[model samples]
Target: MNYAHLKEELIEYSKTIGIDKLGITTADPFLSLKDRLIAQQENNFASGFEHSNIDERVDPRLSVQQARTIISIAVAYPSKLKNPPKSLPGKRRGFFSRSSWGVDYHDVLNERLKKLEAFLEARCGPEAMMRMVDTGALSDRAVAERAGVGWSAKNTFIITEEFGSYVFLGNLITTIPFPVDKPLEDLCGSCTKCIDACPTGAIVEPGVLNAQVCLSYQTQTKGFMADEFRSKIGNHLYGWDTCQLVCPYNKKIPQPAHKEMEPDPEKVKPLLLPLLSLSNKEFKREFGHMAGSWRGKKPIQRNAIIALAHYKDQTALPKLVELMHDDPRPVIRGTAAWAIGKIGDSKKEENELLIAKKREEDQEVLEEIDKGLTLLGFAVEK
Candidate 1:
């Protein structure tokens, strides 16, 4: 088989199908990434969302028996919103990271991969290929780095010279032996923009992220946000991109070729107050297509409450007070209490908080109530 000709044909076909970048590498074990993953685990820096087994993540052969060549593809996403809605007072807005904008890339990339898989199956056999996106057992970044799709930047993103860092990566492991592409040279010689710009200093070192401290990771968490991050999350309802926004590569990238990724200003920067009351169906209808809704409504609502608090929007006091008094979820109720206190129309909301405090049974909720009261300069009777 003339695999070199096949590789060229595949690259040409990829451009026709909207794949912004494509590269190939031998499907050998990712020796260096294995070490890094182990170190991330040992240092408690992993996001806990990754596939826990190190071997499964580093070896393509484990995922696809007799794997020979790995095909890596990138689809560029838009970095700028076309016409963003204003975040005026009494109508505060929350930001979803650029990654979550437009249709979820998972579906878009999977469709492209499926087409590529079909092309390969026609040439080889149907049994010759396996593919994966972000949720796959193999590391997408490792595959992209090895395949020369991009250099692994200090911000931990694949920085393609063409697409910069705003690219969605996926890979296909096939038994066909194609010549491998060499990895790109790292262009980030002395720049520390992403590290210096991280709001929580999650990038403990270049290319090393402590996900626990990452504002992006914190936004997706379901529990009550730690006190320290509550004020820092600002109006970000889902995911944070301070690190990526600061990268020089991301800043200079051309407009995205994929219209599917263009941000609907209303959805990515939705009004924060309306999110607090979204029914399951409403939340699904509004944000289900976006990547950030994967954790469901509670985390989004929890982060919405935090965004409200971050703004200290006094006009939201009534709704926040209602949540503190009537919401069934302890996290929402407690966070509302905290926000109400933080906003501090002391005479108006302090009585309501005291009353809620007396009846609240959850120990965590009680602690939040006490914190709220303390923030409001009220002496605790108990």
Candidate 2:
């Protein structure tokens, strides 16, 4: 196929395959943000991958072996129903960040990209080689910006002119030379909503996100949920979206392009009693496919206990007590202790206080223990 003709066909094919926006970049332009990349690594915020190795990820000249043009695609996830479920009453339902509500995008994007690759191979045959890159050294947002589809916002997200920042990005690195578009200029002038709205201060500064402090990172992280940060978690059981919710760009984006992203009514505002006693196997069977399940059941279980505790719903006391002593994971047990104190009666509270004292470690749990004691009409000066 001729160069211009091939490019046009490919773009049309991408749209047909369900991509909302498609554009081409001559090379990754986000390469210039080296200092920001290094800062992320130094600060332990690089998503466990180096951003400095853009050349390694999709080096059109090397990795793709004669890569001439990079194609970038954006998947919009705008939610028409705005606002997370109010941790309060009479408010709109808030669910997981729209990006994470359904089947993992990693799976979705890769599947589509693979289909596109097969189509291209059939057309170009021995004349072309194509590679699909996601979540690697390649700067997806940078490539998207270079393609004139969007600009990098202060939140380090590519904000599309039409869709705002509620877009998931994927890119194709190929040897096919195609016309390239100019990069979009930064559009996040004087907007500090994402930075100011972060609960755990993860934003740190404009255009910088210290992932260690990011709530989304914490919720899905394995092992312990850091105690100092627990209170900021609020009622978020799986993921946090405080910053994204506050972003002006996310305003009025259509809700869940795919109906699958909508929360299962059974799962939404789940009753605390059941989650408090969920077995690991059962937990896995239920949430395994959802984005919230990425960190496994421990985090979700822990969050559930905390929310119950914070809710101070006394009806959950027996379940919380059972979880405090019976749950195998210490994080769950510890949060249970705190929760027991919050919702348990004098007798149940006293029992949990004793258990908390014997814990002998995990200061956060211990604090919960002490609070339980104090609430139960007992005094222990430590």
Candidate 3:
């Protein structure tokens, strides 16, 4: 394989496939990623499926025979329509973080990588094999930084001067020996916009995040969650985007050019009442093709209930009452109770007090019921 021309062809092919940026790097830079794997698991900040063995993920021995090079690529999915609707009365809005508001990127990236790998084999002979995308546990952001695609920001996101941190990353690991590139230095000097803007304080310190406290993670989990986190989750249904919205780099970049990536008008501003009544089947049909559908209907519905509670929208009272009594998940039931308290009047409050009296075992739900009763001029039956 002629290394020089192979490198040039790879860059040209990536651009042809519509990738925003591409880079070549040696696999050796990932040696340090194994060291932090344990601490990440212990802190519970790592994704549930994140490989615990750092060596297994980054080691070429596990991924490919005689692996020598990695081809890193980035795809930008910037939002063309900005200004998410405000939290005002009678305004229906559902904010899916830019990442989740389109067809899943993983599938798109994998197809592109496979095509590139096939081209390599056709040119470089049959000795090369490819492991594409985020597989093999390689540190993609680290690789992209080293390859000169972008710099790693203090927000723990890769910030490209041209595309910002909105680019989706994927990689091709192969046995071909390509020339490696140098990494850029971190350029997020003293910028704390992301850290300070986090509503749940999930970004505890510079470049560190606790996924448990993140609204993104909370919307993907089931069961009763912390009350404190609930109040701050705001109107986000799938993920949080406050940090990216405040970033200067993102502001300077042009909006997405792809029309298919635009938020669906029907989905862009989902009504809370309709979302609350979604059966599992309906939810799967509606959002099954999207990324946020992985956790099913429960979390999305729960998030909508939280937004209603935060807004104190009385129009949602009937829906909240129905959910309070009928929701199979206790966490959803508890959240419904909280929303009802914020919206219901004295008569409806007394109805909820009776319901609470029948099943007061769940301390969380009972607490919400008590607050509702108090707000509606009811006395505690002490």
Output the number of the lDDT-best candidate. 1
What are the per-residue Cα lDDT tens digits for candidate 1 across 1-382?
Answer: 8989989999999999989999999989999988999999999999999987899899989989889989999999988888899998999998999999989999999999999999888887765788799999999998999899999999898899987898999999889999899999999999999999887888899999999999889999988899999879888888887777888887767887677788889999999999999999999999999999999999998888888888889989999989999999999999999988888766768898889988999999998998888889898767
lDDT of 1: 0.90
lDDT of 2 at 366: 71
- The candidate scoring highest on TM-score is 1
Q: For every model shown, what is its TM-score relative to the native structure?
A: 0.98, 0.85, 0.89
Worst 10 contiguous positions by lDDT, candidate 1: 122-131
Candidate 1, residue 340: Cα displacement in angstroms equals 0.3
Residue 108 displacement (Å), model 2: 1.3
Write the number of the candidate with greater lDDT, choosing between 1 and 3. 1
**Candidate 2 per-residue C-alpha lDDT over 247-319 given as tens digits, one digit per residue, 9 for 90 to 100:** 8987776554554455554454455456656677887776666656766667777777666656677767776
Report how far off residue 157 is in candidate 3 (Å): 0.7
What lDDT is obtained when candidate 2 is compared to the true structure? 0.68
Candidates' C-alpha lDDT = 0.90, 0.68, 0.74
lDDT, candidate 3, 51-152, per-residue tens: 556776667547776778878888888655565555457655566677776677777777778878888888887756665655447767777887888997
Off by over 4 Å in 1: none
